[model samples]
Target: MKIFEAMAGLMTDLTAIGKDQKNVQQGFKYRGIDQVYNALHPLLAKHKIFTTPEVLDKTREERTNAKGTVLAFVTMRIKYTFWTDDGSSVSCTVEGEGMDSGDKASNKAMAIAHKYALLQTFCIPTEDMDDPDAQVHEIAPRAKPRVSDQQVEQLRKALTVAGMDEAQWCASVKIPSLESLPEEKFGGAMDYIKKAALAA
Candidate 1:
């Protein structure tokens, strides 16, 4: 896929939880390397492509701007190698910098760094093997991630089950999770349901 194509593909069907919610209340920053990888997994599978993630190098130093603002800067280089099913040697390797100013926006900026990275890898277009000058280039900035309700519900359930109160379940009590949305998706809820059914 060309650079824009890959970025567009991810933008088109990317699914994340708590990444962006300006549209709702529960919207928050969800940062995870696996989350981004998972979003790209299906696209890779459908398009006969795959990726290998690796950490390349890191550096920490003091950078000062013309405005005389000095800050401790950390730059992380993460590589995402895209591959084809037949292993014909098709891939896009991108390098992006992650910055932090010790503020709330820094949190969001770091998240975007992940999105930017995966998107850029997707954007690096394919080229004819004979064309030596067909390398992809950088593009533009992106907004925060857009998560779906289904993903949110799934996360809620996962968290609840991992930290469920077994005593409450033995007493046949309802655990509404942190949001009290519903117990339908929670696995703990099902555990008790099976117990009750066996008791009958």
Candidate 2:
């Protein structure tokens, strides 16, 4: 039989576990990594399916607000491969992101990547017990910022005065080009241009 058929057969007898309370934060309950492993391990062993994850790449960006609060965002590209006992295998690559306020950002991002990879590929289901006090944390995403012609020209002039070209300026701001600069990073770009103007 095919690997996916085998995995589907194994999932038939599996059941979901409750949300982990030990690591709940901000009124939101999250399933821990251990819980996922505990549920999947026995089934995998019994079916002779080997699951492995390889991290293809990872990237991180950090921004600090005026009040000294640091926010970290990390993204990872991961490949999950499932091998059957009969020399058949399948693989999937997934991207996962995690955000945190401190030093554990990378670890959190990796854990999220692994959790999702397994969850999606195996189609695992979790317990549906309801929590009356469970808080739903949701925020609308901000619209992308726009840059005006005047702002772009001003930045160009600043670059010329600083004896630097657009490529150099873009590199300083960690962007591809001045026109492609995101609206959220406008303040930082302006700060960098002002410093360059002074140094010129």
Candidate 3:
């Protein structure tokens, strides 16, 4: 029998696993890795399917604050291979991204990749959790400029050296708060600060 046909046979008896994890802020529930693997095991065994995952490539990015706080982000490209007892095999590639403050970013990315790969292959129905249209999204009138946290910190230091009150500086730029300053305004904000310093 074809691998898909055998898989379908297993799916016929598969049960829905409850989403046991909750994201309080997001107000949503999601299945964890344990749930996914638990749901997949019996089906894989029944269908005589062997699954293998390989890391094809990986990349990392990090941002460190002067205060010693660090944020790590990673992107990983992985390949999932499915083999049948008859020597037939199929493979797919998945890219996963994750960010964390510590050393677990790579592990998080790998978990994300595996979850997605299994979700796709098993056609796991995530009830009402899908966006049917990929192209429809709010487009900003202009590209939001990129602002680095380092730049923000530097600006704050410069403001302090100039004896300028941070609140007043933010107000001059029509920003209600420093944190609310948009990326596009960073250049203008910096220019204002430089002019103020020269005047001082």
Candidate 4:
């Protein structure tokens, strides 16, 4: 009962936290952990609410980026317990992930987990903040496999039988050479050659 009363009091006093920090690389605004702590610390003390964190699980791995830079990736599941003076408390568990080129990956992960736990537990209002769910990430398309050497030879023979110039056909297809033609287009190219041969 005391824990609920303290939570409700904190929630009433904690108004919307503005997006005070900008991610320069990604061009979005966010509320940093420091902002959350600065806003919550005094109010938490006022309400006689204190919290402790326990790391329930942790994992770390090393990965190489496209530029061959090695990075450490860490993920942690943390449980935070909010306690009042009379042994009244509530717990929240959350998972956080971080990646860095140095040794601070785990620290970053823990901070993220702690921040989320506090925000969610208190149901803090963050109006007009850029939500991660609203962001879109673009992935590069995979390169298509080119035709094999044998397929190139077959196309050349078909071109000869059809009385079509290799250069003209390549120009029409906008490819540098038959060898560069994608495997998926090989059947269509062969069908065109067969039609030309029949017409010739």
Candidate 5:
């Protein structure tokens, strides 16, 4: 994976774990970016690579609906500069397309964008990063409710099957706790559950 992709993947994985209310803020979790950046340090050390990924371009491309709710999308241009172990480097540009101007894409988006950016290959000296004063702002943005309608639309089908029509499905249905279910029961139980789904 490209440096940007690897970093983004790390951020995505960390963000996934913080979806609970313990991380919620103004419709988002706070400090997720810092957490992602911290996670990146060890990975970077292991990968033997360095990168500088930054926002290169941003534009709002969205249309408001009749209901007064704005459904805006963002076209973010990312620039990723990569350095290799053997004193070589390169710069790449990647585009990130999100749902709206302010709608943050998933951690997967970040990772994929980074990968696309680093697809370019050239060469630069590793010594160029010797500047002690230069600091890398490694972090994911603050966690936010940035999931897209498409994902929700898709999830509607799954949630219906899970009998999660209401947000509090845990209280609505009593099933064997996932932990109590034997590992071997997973496949058969899932198949049975799928077939038993009620019409929504």
Candidate 6:
């Protein structure tokens, strides 16, 4: 049989896998890789379908978490090819990332890539699909450099030439003072002031 026929047979027999594994630390439930393997292996064998994995790219780094704990983070891009006995095949590439405090980061990354490859290739069904919006991350806001004293003086002169109130102009840009304007916004502010001066 061709790869498409074999895949159709497998999909017909495959059932929706539930999210049985729980992340106690994070309080989330997900379908484990083992669960996917258990559900697909028999159907795949019955349909004479097989798969092979190739690592396209991989990167590793050491990162410190919010708690100051050091961890090994690994990201891997993998390609999986599904084939039938008749030699017809299909392929897919996926990227996975994993972080671990110990030596298993790479292994975890590979498993994640494999899991997604299978899940997406076969169109596997899950009772409760994972949603990115379900989680929230607290990120510290970066402080932007404000305008220099010289730039603030330039802005004040421009404001005067434009016949605009300093406090009102600052309030329009949501800054307490001319010096409080972010450096990146200075150019736009100058452009606006120039336009106002021309209109005046």
Best model per TM-score: 6
Poorest 10 consecutive residues of model 4 by lDDT?
122-131
Best of the two (1, 4) by lDDT = 4
Going through the candidates in the order shown, the clash numbers are 4, 0, 0, 0, 5, 0
Candidate 6's residue-wise lDDT over 1-200, tens digit each?
A: 39998898899888999998999999989989999999999998999989998999999999999999999999999999999998999999999999999999999999999999999888898878866799899999999999999999999999999999999998987889898899999999999999999998
What's the lDDT for candidate 6? 0.92
lDDT of 4 by residue, 95-185 (tens): 9999999989999999999999988888787778566899999989999999999999999999999999999999998999898999999
Candidate 1 residue pairs in clash (backbone atoms < 3 Å)? 2-125, 3-123, 3-124, 3-125
Put down candidate 5 lDDT per residue, 64-133, tens digits, no spaces: 7677767666667778776656656557778866553255543434655664443223111122223457
TM-score per prediction, in order, is 0.31, 0.58, 0.63, 0.65, 0.31, 0.68
| Prediction 1 TM-score vs. true | 0.31
Q: Considering lDDT, which of the candidate structures 2 and 4 is the better prediction for this target?
A: 4
Point out where model 5 deviates above 4 Å: 1-44, 65-68, 84-88, 101-112, 118-200
For 81-128, candidate 2 gives per-residue lDDT tens digits of: 888977788888988888778788878888888887777777676675
Give model 2's TM-score versus the native structure.
Answer: 0.58
> Which stretches of model 1 miss by more than 4 angstroms?
1-39, 62-73, 99-114, 123-200
The residue ranges of model 3 lying beyond 4 angstroms of the native Cα positions read 64-68, 134-136, 144-200
Residue 156 C-alpha lDDT in model 5? 46
* lDDT of each residue in 37-64, candidate 3, tens digit only: 9888878888888779999999998977
Q: Lowest summed lDDT over 10 consecutive residues: which window, candidate 6? A: 123-132
Per-residue accuracy of model 1 over 97-197 as CA lDDT, tens digit each: 54444543334434455566665554422221223477676878764343346644554454355564444542444433333434344455455445554
Cα shift from native, residue 62, model 1 (Å):
7.2
Superposed Cα RMSD, model 6: 6.5
